[model samples]
Target: MSPARSDRTRRPVDLRQRSTMAGEASAAEAEVEMALDAPPDPQAAAFFDVDNTVIQGASIFHFARGLHRRKFFTTRDLASAAWKQLLFRVVGSEDPEHVAEARASALAFIKGHTVAEVEALGEEIFDEAMAARVWPGTKALAQLHLDQGQRVWLVTAAPVELASIIARRLGLTGALGTVAEHEDGVYTGRLVGEMLHGPAKAEAVLALATRESLDLSRCTAYSDSINDLPMLSLVGEAVAINPDARLRAHARDAGWRIRDYRTGRKAAWAGVRLGAAAGAVAGAAAVGAALRRKR
Candidate 1:
């Protein structure tokens, strides 16, 4: 096997063994009780979808502003993007066509931009603004996995650079996102493959599982929209956080856990007979990485 592939497969096995050992030695019985319905698997993972699942809105909206300041796009372009952001907030993005169009628009906009330049801008914007908008409950859950020694990864359609920033700041393992094609340190205005949405998200998680030796039946996934159904369905534990209409219906019928924090009310979980609530986690810093499409 190639050295790169060999390392990818070997590293996760090592980490999993270490995690399993750590979890077994942990004395946090209370936390374990909360997730008793689906017992913890140290070798598995807790995958979270970004955007509405973890943060208030699309990370791309803020990234657009940053790019505008740097003259990547103009005032008129920013206004249009802002309008779309408002609509996304009210009406969740579940439509495949809508997602595709957004992806195309973002790819077109960033064409020819140097990867390093865009990544640097993304870091600045995220540190300045995006950190405050993360949902406390979701952040807590991600942290719980970390405390238990399970892998935690942010799965989104945002650029890998932006996703990596959010994941690192949140103290999670890493991220999987859309890959933009670049050559000689410059973007080629094309994608490496499909945008990481819908089935693409599911494929990425499965690939990670293969490399990590993660048990899909023991893994958990959280999302807020229907577009992530394939991913949510792949895991033993599926959580719907601030779910849109479609996902809420599906979660209800499937008896999956649901948490709603959009109404200024305390977030409550539904359909699970758990001993305790997932413990509260301290707020972490958030940041806008860039204007990229998310499903």
Candidate 2:
């Protein structure tokens, strides 16, 4: 086997072992209990990817927009992030550079900020920017799992704080997300580990399964990106929701279930619509300026 493939295969085991040793596995289970009052489903659970799978767009982008509106960052920063967001929306996949840039920017802004402060703002941001963006179909699927007495968790590359807020609002069991380290209630501008993404996501699921006493053969996972193949493959049942081209093709080859919520027209016009919206905003601003000059 190629070295890269070999490493990918072994990484999950390493991560699972480390997380169990660090007590994070048990902590993840505790978070689920604290977040929900439902009866335990020790043998099965569901994992959902957050970005395009559960919501209409990238969750972190919306959170960043909210932070910009709150004056947490400059307009130049927002413009840069907006470009990346546009690319993600158009391409429907993660870009490593864009992800790194976003992580660095987020950490920079939250440095020295209290955890409570960020969590409080995350709550407001979710209400303002994220709640309305949730895909009704995806929400229904999650609800279906909940109805079946299975614990549902969101696995995303977004910060744990934001991910948890989404879970609580959606009435899910909990979430697994990239953890930014903090000390004495304040952010240290460093992550506890790598972002909960790709293989890392699979590792998290494995650790959580071990802690929660869940059977991998009974668990299901849903996602939109091919990057999540590790996580999806680790589970017994995998569903692709609004998947990108690569994932759609892979799912077909693998015989996994696929669900596309976007109409053909909607998918084709997504980038055009975003461009038109930006033009409209600029036109409105110009018209307002003209009126002010007349006054």
Backbone clash numbers for all candidates listed: 4, 0
Residue 45 displacement (Å), model 1: 0.3
Whole-structure CA lDDT of model 1: 0.62
lDDT of 2 by residue, 54-78 (tens): 9776777676566657656566655
Off by over 4 Å in 1: 1-42, 69-72, 79-103, 264-295
lDDT of each: 0.62, 0.68
Q: Against the true structure, what is each candidate's TM-score?
A: 0.70, 0.75
Candidate 2 TM-score, C-alpha based: 0.75
Shift in Å, residue 214, candidate 1: 0.8
Q: Distance (Å) between predicted and true CA of 26, model 1? A: 32
Q: What's model 2's overall lDDT?
A: 0.68
lDDT of 1 by residue, 109-166 (tens): 4565587876787788788767987889889999988777687888876666777788
- Model 1 earns a TM-score of 0.70
Give candidate 1's error at residue 105 in angstroms: 2.3
